[model samples]
Target chain A: MQLADRIEKRRFVGRELLLWLWMESELFDGTLHTEEHGAFGFWLEKQLVLSAESESTSIKAAAPGLGREAKEALLRGQLPERFAVRISKDDEETSLVLTGDTLALRALKLATVLDKKEEAVIGDLVDELAGRTRGRKKKKAESEEDEETPFYERMSKAAEVEALLGTLYRDFLRLRLDARWDAVVVPTMRQWAAGEDVDADAYRAAKRGKSTKGAKGAKAAKGTRK
Target chain B: MSALSGSLSYSRFFVTLQGRDGTIRSAGSAADGSLPRGFLDRSYEKLLHHAMRPLDADEPESERSGWCVLGDPLDVSLPKERVYLEGFVNLGFRTDKWVIPGAMLRTRLRQAELAYREQVGREKLSRRERAELKEVVTRELRKKLVPSTRAVDLTWSLDEGLVRFFSHTASAMLSMVDLFEKTFGAKLVAESPYTLASRLRGEDDPIALDDEALWEALTPTILVPEGDA
Candidate 1:
């Protein structure tokens, strides 16, 4: 097959990725992990859209994925088309709407440390005004650094979030391309979608079973536990 | 969303630099500054060559698109200092389109046709004459109107080989990609499921199977079984 054909055909994988993410988020109680980022709070928020062919369902709520309608849509053969998600690591929290087919991130709100930095800058300025410290050259250099700090912080945080996403995608691919996908993931995913209670430990054990390739899948699955 | 301020929303694209041998490769690490020597200088020159041109009232072209200063679209003076940031090549994609209201055009055309007929002492005009009158009327109307302009911020992270285009609209992305390829001789593969997967798998992984074969054999998971559904 041509490259374009392969890309087009695999576009559905994006929807499946989102579906898998939603299932894992609920089963793991909004905590998902990767080898890189130990465990992060991952959950659907604000909106969730699922569609198949001529029909689509859009749910807007504090937790759209927890609703019965979303599950019903899944049963109707619809997959998540796009959804708003909130991810938190330590004190940092990020939110964005992720489009399934293109995996495009929209309205990405990265956690900002600007307020604290601005406060520190204001304190320094106050000290200078009170004649508590600083020379002209020193003050000039400090102010210049202040001006560039927030931008660098913002870019750095954005990069960190992108890296986190990259690792998550890698983990998903590891399971997706392995025999564990059909043997374990799909059944448990179906159970979760049907509102059936799933034993997280059993699911993890099955995911780490011999069906997976060697020790890599088992090690990654181990990381998923809190 | 603007890159410098306001909300942060963007479409990500991975840059693939093509060599003289027609082979494609992902951009090198930012830490090593792995771009070929003088590549930055060459790219800067190309950026200058393709800088945005404001629409002229007398020009016949209905639309035009090109690059400009990131935050200030009006400033097309892309001095190297303004174009290059710490580790990023930041710029804006500006498009200007002349939009003449259809009703106004029809009205002006009718008036022009009537005046022309009277001047020639003819009650009716031929098809060719009408077409010429319409063109003339459109040009006159265009001169009286301003082109609508839109600017979207785009930042290229030199080290990461990633371009964050602020807008998600298809037309805007198409124009930006076309202009970008022209400005820098590199193909941009937009971030998608397949591309991300392949990239994460390491393009140079020796043990990796052929991507085409692996991806081709894959099928979509059936979330709802036939009997179960």
Candidate 2:
């Protein structure tokens, strides 16, 4: 469904909101699952979890019916080709593992009742991760033990995990927005942009570009010519 | 002159800038250009979070020196209803030698554009021949590495007359702010606004419009708010 439509219906919940978003957003299709056994299980799995944490607080409450296969997928880190999953270690806690573009992540995050400030906070984490990796050169400054270490593990000294959790909490706020972001807001923004007085006209103009396109029709240009 | 020398890959060459307040911003490939200027704001702090460490090579540290923390990405978003690319870096900033030279910058942009066109050419179908080509391009692009939103950089410089730009990967359109800022260190000389259009059917020119005029011409659509559809 169009995110706007979904947003209006108010049917999306935490991990589901993130799952739907990660799968459908412009970036790519991926899954979210929670992994237990801590970081050890996380590494043993084939698929990588985007969030640093193994589980989120709300995983259990959202998906009471989560089965062994799904849980195993999280444990093995095996993600399907076109989906994203979030695995929480606590079975109740939830975190997302999205494989898509920035915009997709933004939408899913925004869908939850996340305020701009929280989003900005997550945006900070993204910036931090992107910055830390920039212009980095790969050389063995340490022994074989360092080589076996996961990349994130190396980042431990730099506090990458802590920073990721900060973003995770911010992301959770966004997940809740899925339950809170009213699809009605789309029309509101469109109405504001058009500077039109009528809500109906704004809604139509926003829904279909007909009004805006027609507004800029030939007559407007010809009238200016005179 | 060149990107920090070492076998740099996508992960190693990037850095995460955390605002003291808490936000995540992305900088481009080391070779592409430096981070955007918004990251340089007071709340921002740079972390050498990841670097590509070669298996067994020794390299000089000075190669990585030009790397400075730019500003946050969100703070420099495009102004409301503007057609312009936001946060372009002024090229004159390179005059100090910390930045790459304009001539070299132009060549890199040109090369990137050529590679993009060549990829399209391999299909033997013009972009217009099939509606899906755009999707293909978009999808493939999503898979590849990207440094930042817009190509090139724009920033505030002490000078008012000259514009400066640090070029990045050549995307569909080269940002006008990048062009103008690189060209003029200061604000536009004229009071009147100018239109930025492609000189040819496909080329993008900077200085097409000052910020004010561009915003007036654009109509906000669902695409902007819901994310690039």
Candidate 3:
């Protein structure tokens, strides 16, 4: 197929990715892990939008995914079109709305470093009050650096969030392209979405074993079984 | 959302370079160093060349769009210092369009037509005459009015090959992409699930499975079985 056709066809993968994320977030109790980032806080928050061809359901609450209507929408063949998500790692929280088809992040609010800067400003005031004198040029340079600090910090934080999302997408792809997707993940997801009890521990064990087996097979094929 | 300040909200696009043979290459491959030597100087010249031109009442063009200084739509001077900020090329995409209300235009045209007919001592005007009068009226009205202008900030990280366009509107993005490709001679691919997946998989992993086939064969999971809802 042509590149454009492939891109258009795979757009649905984004909605499925969001749906899987919502399910995993709930099943894992608002925490998900990857080899790179270990465990991080992740959950759907504030808003959730699910839609089929003609009908759509929009839910807004502290945790919209926990509502019964969200599950009902899923059962009715609606996938998440867009939803707000909150992810926290190392006490730094980032919130953004994820659009399914484009996987575009909108209104990404990164953790602010201004409070720390405020403290630093107070310290600078104290230094000035203590009669500490500095060269005019040096002081001007310092002030300029201070002005740029927050922008750089914000960009850094934003890049960090992007990297986290990239890693999460990678993990999702690994499962999605594997046999375990239909064998394990989807069955449990169906049970959970239908308001039926799902054994989280059992699912995790099965998922982990399958992944390990796949890795071993790959290693063996590479002649590195040991 | 402003790049220098305000709450962060933007759309991400991955930049790619197209070769002469029509092959698309990853931005990472092209990003060998910090935008290459004298690249900024060359880009500054291009910026000046394509800088926003305010709509002129005398001109026939009703709409125009181009780059301007970030946070200042009126300032199209695009000084290098204001645009090339610490590894990022920040600029504002500005569009100006003259919008004349239909009712107002009709009223003005009618007045012009009447005045022209009275001056020429004619009770009726031909179709061509009416068209010429309407054009004259529109130009006169444009002289008395200002074109509405919209400016959205865009920041391009030269190192990361990513562009953060502050506005998510489709038209604005399309305009920006067109302007960017024209100005920089590079293509931009908007961030999507497929593109992101391809990038995260890395460029050198030849053993990686075929993405097209994988994605094509995939089916949406049935979260709820039949009659389960």
DockQ of each model against the real complex? Answer: 0.34, 0.01, 0.33
Candidate 2 Cα misplacement greater than 4 A, ranges: A1-65, A72-97, A100-106, A111-226, B1-229
Candidate 3 residues lying further than 4 Å off, grouped into runs, are A113-149, A211-226, B20-22, B29-38, B120-124, B202-210, B225-229
Candidates arranged by TM-score, highest first: 1, 3, 2
lDDT of 1 by residue, B28-115 (tens): 5323325778888998888988998988867778899999998788999888888888988889999999899999998889899889
Better of 1 and 3 by DockQ: 1
Instruction: Give stretches of model 1 more than 4 Å off.
Output: A113-149, A210-226, B29-33, B202-210
Q: How good is the docking of model 1, by CAPRI class? A: acceptable
DockQ, candidate 1, comes to 0.34
The candidate maximizing DockQ is: 1
In model 1, what are the clashing residue pairs, if there are any?
A: none
Model 2 TM-score (B-chain only): 0.19
lDDT of each model, Cα atoms only? Answer: 0.80, 0.27, 0.79
Which tens-of-lDDT digit does each residue in A1-226 have in candidate 3?
7766777877888898899899989999999998789999999999999998899999999999998999989999899999999998887777889888988777776666333444456766777788765444444654455445566677777788888888788777777766667667777777888899989889888776545223333323224211
Give the per-residue lDDT digits (tens) of candidate 2, residues A1-226: 4423432232212223233332222111122221212231111122323221363212232332133443333233222221223332332222323321111110111111123334445655676677753221212322232333442222221223223322332332222222112232233433333333435444333333322122233234323431
